[model samples]
Target: DAMVIQNPRYQVTQFGKPVTLSCSQTLNHNVMYWYQQKSSQAPKLLFHYYDKDFNNEADTPDNFQSRRPNTSFCFLDIRSPGLGDAAMYLCATSRDNGNTEAFFGQGTRLTVV
Candidate 1:
């Protein structure tokens, strides 16, 4: 019962190239989040989209973008990815904005060369 699914466990992209990672959830959670985790570092919140509302973290760069077409699907787009962008992109879903438990996908590892 995989509630959250992220496609293509691994990916590689050239510098300045664009790449898209996808996630889908079956739990129908109200909040969907995207996070970037570098090696041995904490996962940094990139953005979260819920109920048609999108929230981006202040420190997130312009190169990162996210789209939540519906409750079940979300996509993370990296435009002109730099070497610094290489990391694991994690997709998570929570029942609501409150202190509900969150379910995370296995994550898509992106390599920017």
Candidate 2:
């Protein structure tokens, strides 16, 4: 399908270890977003890339960082992930922010061990 694809449907990392989740698409969308969702909580938008411009949510912790090397790809880097950071990380893309429906991947579930 010509939509978003996330690598490694699940991940397990040791406590305090760093982890990187990846997202890619064939849609050539210009905006890519990264979100975190925990049990019983709504998905939280961590940051997004509109082309080469980066926008991070104010509430997003410094532990979260993102990179978009091109229009079809983005990466989420969790530096020194803690047990509390275990959650589902999602990747989504749209032609433009709020201009069209966003396409999402199946999500990468992270577990801290």
Candidate 3:
């Protein structure tokens, strides 16, 4: 399967705590992305790594950070979690940027305590 795998499928952090979510792709892809999805809302693109370049979405919050140390792996770090930041974090991969087929992991559900 052309799959993206996310670790520790669910996470709960104390308010203002820092948390990091990880993703690894089985398929060798050029584009890896991180998105945040809240209940009843669309999945919002936070950032992406196209090869060695990093692209951050305009409206993505400063609290969100990402790192692509290598093509096969990426990391999403939430600097400080808040009640409003609790949501499902999705990791995805594609051959290229937008307008292409992307495969997503099951997602990590983050809860703020």
Number of the predicted model whose TM-score against the real structure is largest:
1
Candidate 1 residue pairs that clash:
none
Lowest summed lDDT window (length 10), candidate 3: 1-10
Candidate 3 lDDT tens digits, 61-93? 999999999899999999999999999999999
TM-score of each: 0.98, 0.96, 0.95
Question: How accurate locally, in lDDT, is each candidate?
Answer: 0.95, 0.91, 0.93
Looking at candidate 2, the ten consecutive residues that score lowest on lDDT are 1-10
Which is the winner by lDDT between candidate 1 and candidate 2? 1
lDDT of 1 by residue, 6-107 (tens): 998999999998999999999989999999999999999999987689999999999999999899999999989999999999999999998899899999
How many residue pairs clash per model? 0, 0, 0
Best by lDDT: 1
Tens-place lDDT per residue, model 2, 1-113, is: 63889988999998888889999999988889999999989989999998999999999999888888888789999998998999999899889988599989999999999
**Stretches > 4 Å off in candidate 2:** none
lDDT score of residue 21 within candidate 2: 92
